[model samples]
Target chain A: MNKMTRQFEGYSFIGLWIIGFMAFSLGPLLFSLIISFFKWSLLDKPVFIGLKNYIDMFKLDPLFWKSLKVTFTYAVVSVPLGLIVSLLLAILLNLKLKGMGIFRTLFYLPSVITGVAAAVLWMWVLQPDFGILNYFLSFLGIQGPDWLGDPNWALTSLIMMSVWGSGGGIVIFLAGLQNIPQLLYDVSSIDGATKFRQFRAITIPMITPSIFFNLIMGVIGAFRTFTQGYVMTNGGPLNSTYFYALYIYNKAFQDLQMGYAAALSWILFIIIAVLTLLVFKTSSSWVYYETERKG
Target chain B: MNIFGKSVTYAFLIISSFVFIIPFIWMVSTSLKEPGAIFAFPPQWIPDPFLFQNYKSAWTIAPFQQFLENTVTIVVLTTIGTVISSSIVAFGFARLVFRGRNVWFAILLASMMIPYEVTIIPLYVEFKLLGWIDTLRCLIVPSFFGAAFNIFLLRQYFLTIPYDLDEAAIIDGCSTFQVYWRIMLPIVAPALVTVAIFQVMNAWTDFMGPLIFLNDQRNYTLTLGLNLFRNSYLTEWNNLMAIASLVTVVPLIIFFIGQKYLIGGIAASGIKG
Candidate 1:
């Protein structure tokens, strides 16, 4: 009787959490999925319009395709660039040196100053006439483009800011680098392996898991790039920075096309799911796990 | 490494640090400059005659004090609620052998992938039905339920605590709730602090939540307040930068104070993932 009572007590503790999950998360998720099939606005009753929202998003919407392209381009360009830059920085920081922690913290600062503050700060930083970026460009004898204002450079400018803020990835990669056994590097050195050779052979393989993790996360994060667009550009300079999330936000809230926005979000969900699944499917070939190694 | 290699690394680190820190330095510089000096040719790194009044002007231009008060209330409530709820829920997952625990845990993990955009619409409708649309409750109450990432993070930390501690507590006639509160919670204080810091940062920097839900300027968090301030004062770059710098200082201070815990928490999540 005592054991049974304890079990019930334990179950009830988690039961509270389950109730919350259903009410806030799971229930809302199902509601959105259902509403994606209807024509609902806040002021009107939700009219059943099965599959039409999806159909319109695919067939009728040009901005949908444009936003999709913009988001994908961002993920593709930013993720790889962020990965390579962060990995290089991590490798540099991984060296046994005094005062590396200070540098690490400085590099990681940008990631912490997120949202509207960072966006506003960047607007000034990328200001064409009096901005620091153009000031530097002039010194190099190269004319700088109007960054956030020019349609040609708005998205590129966002990507630049993102790469600068890839400091979090560097920290993560540094942790992964620290986990790589020093013994392996020592053995490689003893066998006359050059730094580059050892890096290619051992370090790359060892840190593939971290790379993979950062890649997936980078993809997810990049696709949801909203604040910069919302705050800095408002998805403008001719909608060049109109990210999918920004588009969805405008659709649902501004235009009051909640059901259409729900459909767009579902499409985004599917794209992310497919992309993530593809990465996982391909990960087996490259991701090296020490515990999985067999003689 | 040799002297040449060391110099190369040092040079690279210095340049990279400059790139990372320049915006902040420039922001502070611009904030202190008079409007005439702000757009000066060959941009001023330092203001000749510091307009220290920019900070004062920035504060008065908008209801920033009220915004800060609003943000602090939300952050404090959410952080405390998240730490408590997530830790307790994580304890159940890490210690208890409840039925369907694995399935539920898997569901928790999977829910992390569902983007906020996917849920925001219905969540808005739900909050509207509850008449929570223009209130701080829309922001604070959902966090009390426990976030999936925080729960997962705490559960990972909880698993590291030896089961013998729980067994010892149970042997002493402690109920599971008592074990969680007395034995487990104290032991996992570091992880709890980490969760608190992350929650505080999230609640502090949250833009979309306030943007969507809070309709009144009086209830606006600092982020929404600052964004609206910028929209209204498009040409007042000096004041905007001043207020932006002021708003950003809180998170910077938090990062500096909890530097070790924040990095360790992030590293823990990354390595485990």
Candidate 2:
């Protein structure tokens, strides 16, 4: 410990920051918890209702199951597909060649686009009649499905959009690719390993850590998806794309069932948390942590 | 490494790149299209008689300028609050030897698990009580407290800065505040930038916050504006797309203009936990 010649005793920066943080966050955080217990809409004062709202959501919310189904369905389908595409894109962009920076920039550009904009752009493209998709389909004498307008295809349409704006994951994949030892690749080349074989042997094993990272993050992100549903379809032609977050949102905010929404939110959080823990537990078998060997 | 494999790689990259770029390219082209040709049976890559009136009309239908102002006001305040709040909190967790520091930090980490859904009910009621609903305060205030994720993310960077800086400053009769403000802050500038960029983008593009909190039409953000377009003009293809294009993509395009800074920011944040 050192003696201070003149301690600045007048102001407390830490206190100011805490005061600021709590001033803004505490009300919302605490208020939300308080409201989760009572049943109230914006019109009337919230009345104490105990666990009735919670019970009702779990037992009776019709759209609850449907929303869960749609969300998990999208998550299950999109996560692996996105992971592979990002990895493949990262591998290509990491090549020893000229103008790769341009390619990298191009691939990452779509991700930064707001989800609303992407939805709007794709809405035009995916419009069944008079849209570009059908026009292309007509050229091949194949008709395109009604994307958002069709109940059956709306969720899938959103899934396709999720895969498109995957620049964030692609960046992480590129970082993982860069961390690979060049000596391993060079040695494999000397052994006359085919590109596919080398990728299987060296690249895949080496990038397991990144794979685990993306897998966990992808699951969490997928579970929390509400933007596309809000933007593109409003959960759809017939609630086809209504995800868990959107469902809780509609129940609490739109429909004004506060307690029920809290219950729903808790359920979704638990499901996601469990899914994350599962991934973490499973990773021990496949994941290659860099420091584990030394320990 | 083989020549044939290299060609295959190039082909995959070129084709996939085209697929990814198509919607963005088409969005720009369609925004400029005349009313008659917005969704012409055959998709037109080039708009004939490129009408820029859609932009003007779109602006009128939805107050793009007003929405821009509202969004900017909210985003700027939130980012400033976030930078001021999160970095200091991160500093406390990174350097302080206070009782319950570990416990409080753990609580912060745990809060990250509690999604927006869990907190929406009480917040809505509280906002109503505080007279915050339909105001920019509702949008900006919740974020000022420093998100758990941001605190954790920045704390990771803060921990990696050499403690020698703090020790030397202490020897020079510097207080903890002086050590934080003068000695340690400069080294973590990139992480601060990263935090700033993330908060800016999140606040700027945020839909749910504005959607729930803002009831007044004038306060709607770009996200809420886009949703309004879908609801109101369900059929007016060209104008809506034009407005959506500018509102949604423009901020990101502008944000990334200094692209190297963002990359450097991420790398700086990457060195720690």
Candidate 3:
């Protein structure tokens, strides 16, 4: 009887959490999937319309394609650029230097200011007129294009801001870099490997796991880019920054097209799911696991 | 390393640090400058008059005190709820040998990847049905259920504690709850603190949740208030900067003080994956 009571008590500890998961996470997910097949306008009764939302998203909606293009462009461009820049920063910081901790802290500072403040700060930084970026451009005897204001440059400006916050990636890469054994480098140097050769041969292969992790995360994160577009441009200057999440937000809240918005979000979920699966499928080709080899 | 290589590395680090640090310095400078001096060519690094009243003006322009109070209430409640609920669920997952535990744990891990956008529509409708719209409950209640990431983090920490300790406690007449509360909780206090910090930062800086769920100005969190303030006071650059700077102070202080745990948490999640 005591054992039975203890067992029941142990299981009951997870009861509230299970209830929450069902109501908030899983229930909502399944409900969204169902509502995507219906016309749910928040007031009117939801009418069943099977696969019409998906068909419209694929065949009829221009903004769907536009937003997808914007999201993909941002993701494809920013992820690689962010990866290289952060890895470079990590490599630089990995150099044995006094006060490297201070530099690391400074680099990591911007990522901590993530929401509206970061968005507002970036708006001023990338302001076309009387902005510091343009002010600095004048010294080069060149005219700076309107960054967030220009149709052609708006998305690019947001990508630049995204790169600025890759400081978190730097911290992650720094941790990965430190995990690499120093003996490997010493052996490479003894074998007359140049510094560049050592990096290409040693650093790149060893840190590929971190790279893979960051790549997957960056793609998911970039696809859902919202706050910056919502704040800085509002998908403006010809919808140049009409990202997928912004579109979903507008459709659901601003336009009251909750059913269609639900459909769009499900499509995004599938896209990320497929992309992540593809990365995992291909990870075996490039991502080196030290344990796999040793074991 | 060679002397030439070392100098090049130092030079790169110093220049990059300046690049990273300049925007913040500029923010503080702009917050203290008069409106007329803000757009001055070859911008003044320092305000001539140092108008500190911009913060006061910024405060009065918005119901910032109310926003702060709302944010504090939300952060404190969410943090406590997250810590308590996540620790409980994590203990069950880590210590108990229940049927279908692995399947449930896997489902929990998979839920982390489902974007908030996928669930926002129904979640909004659900909250509306519950009459939680425009209230703090929409934000705080969901947090009490335990986040997947925090649960996962704490579970990993809990798994490191020896099962022998639980057996010993059981032999000493402690119930399962006692083993969890009196024994495991104190042992995993560091992990609990880590979860609390992450939850506080998350609740404090959360923008999308408040934007979606909140309708009334009185119910706005600091992030929403700052965004609304920016929209209404587009030309008031000094005041905008002042408010933005003010909104950043809590996260900045937390980041500075608990950077080790913060970075360690990230590394743990990233590398273990």
Candidate 4:
């Protein structure tokens, strides 16, 4: 084939993506940024009010601040908790033992049951009186908190739910663990390195990239938390669970503040971008790339 | 490892596994309980009557059949669209050396980092303007354009295949399109399946899309239908559990069936470039 036709075929192969990217991703991205400066409520004409939406968000909107606080708190607590729990689960499952496959599958079962179903399941499990969690707590003579119902425990309850879904992360971390060369551990054992010492020296460094990967993904997932808040709490019990995404949903859909919601989403975008970049910036210090080390 | 240490590990594994598995068991057991028996003290691990009738009631009480039809429609179409389009796009990136290929691929990668919330509002407006809202087209059409992650994944898989095969096909007069359609696609069948399975799970579980796009009750997907069921049957614990169990079990079954590919996709995405 001539170079011209070859080029045409190449472009044709990727043509759908180009159109989709422009229409779905790039175009809307720019549009969202533009509308963030306007004051449209979807029913009226948009009036460009540059920086006012942002200004209002920072200074005037109490729910904006509340949403930010709630989102950040959840991200701060859940990301690390998820990381540690999943990492430990990965390590445990990584041990070559009989029936490990069943245990691994059992651990991962919860993650597949996502969205409204997971929320509903947790709601029943954490029900104040008849829920199994509280029912089990009674056996120990310790009263379980009114888990999704109480303001103090609503966020905590959600955090606990996050742990149950750590099986997804466990699978990723298990893959990372298995990627480590057995020779490293074999050599360390011969050199009289304690198991803890070898793990600290070798295992930790080898999986740092996976840890870094999970951290960024976790941050993004944490900030975009919506379904649980929407279904389970409806951002209620005094808005304790009013996740930022839910707040955006309410503003855009319920309040019809499309412009304001656009601005809010930009703030969320900036926060995620900055956080991910910061992780990337610091990753060089701790995230050990085997290829980089060799080079 | 010492026998004592092995026993401790076994104990820990058993306890943790119980914590994970108990929710599922609780859901099923609760689904079978009579409504009055749901609040029985010390929570019945086994329902007294085993009221499987609740499942029938739950299905009949809502438009669950309609919901299932809608969900299956969206899932099947989106999976087909995503697999075909993403693999073609990925084939171009993996082979076909064109000008600005690297830059375009980089842009695609960067685009994946942009949160869905960033584009959702404007897309909502655009879809509304196009009269796509309140319709399943809004949910299914854009997927035919190719997703960044799936494109990236299939591209990686494509790159792993030897160039000799493509060359061999081309030397025998297979056009680029023919090579892509007949030869390269079959080689990357496993990756295509991975993408298709992930897309199915994604389209099935997706709540926000159907929530924002569809307003008509008849148009609601399973997730939205499940939410509506919860709202209307707020106090009917047995019925609610029955419906939730039904909603949750589909994905559970999918995971069990596609366990290898699902885990492989997750691991491959996590640790690979």
TM-score of each: 0.97, 0.91, 0.97, 0.98
The pairs that clash in candidate 2 are: A31-B122, A32-B122, A32-B123
Give DockQ for candidates 1 onward, in order. Answer: 0.68, 0.46, 0.68, 0.74
lDDT of 3 by residue, A1-295 (tens): 3667646765697776789989998899888898899987887888899999999989999999999999999999999999998999999999898889999998988888887999999888877787788888899987999999899999999998888888989988888889999999999899999999999988998999989989999999999899988999999889999999999999999998888999998898899889998999999888887777733
Residue pairs whose backbone atoms clash in candidate 4: none
- For each candidate in turn, give its C-alpha RMSD to the true structure in angstroms: 1.5, 3.1, 1.6, 1.3
- List candidate 4 stretches off by more than 4 Å: B233-235, B270-273
lDDT of 2 by residue, A255-281 (tens): 877766776777786887788778878
Error of 4 at A166 (Å): 1.1
Q: All models: lDDT?
A: 0.89, 0.77, 0.89, 0.91
- Order of quality (TM-score): 4, 1, 3, 2
* True-structure lDDT of candidate 3: 0.89
Model 3 vs truth, CA RMSD: 1.6
- Write model 2 residue lDDT over B88-155, tens digit each, in one string: 77888887665556766776666666666656666767778899989999878766667677777778
lDDT of 4 at A156: 95
Model 1 Cα lDDT, one tens digit per residue, A42-86: 789989999999998889999999898888898899989999988
Give interface RMSD, per candidate.
1.6, 3.7, 1.7, 1.5
Q: Please, what are the lDDT tens digits per residue for candidate 4 over residues B1-273?
A: 889989999999999999988988999999999888888886778899889899999899988999999999999999999999999999999999877788889999989889888889999999999999999999999999999999999998888889999999989999888989999999878788789889988999999999999999999999999899888835487888898888887788888888888767766564831
Clash count, candidate 1: 0
Candidate with top lDDT is: 4
State how far residue A223 of model 3 sits from its true place (Å).
Answer: 1.1
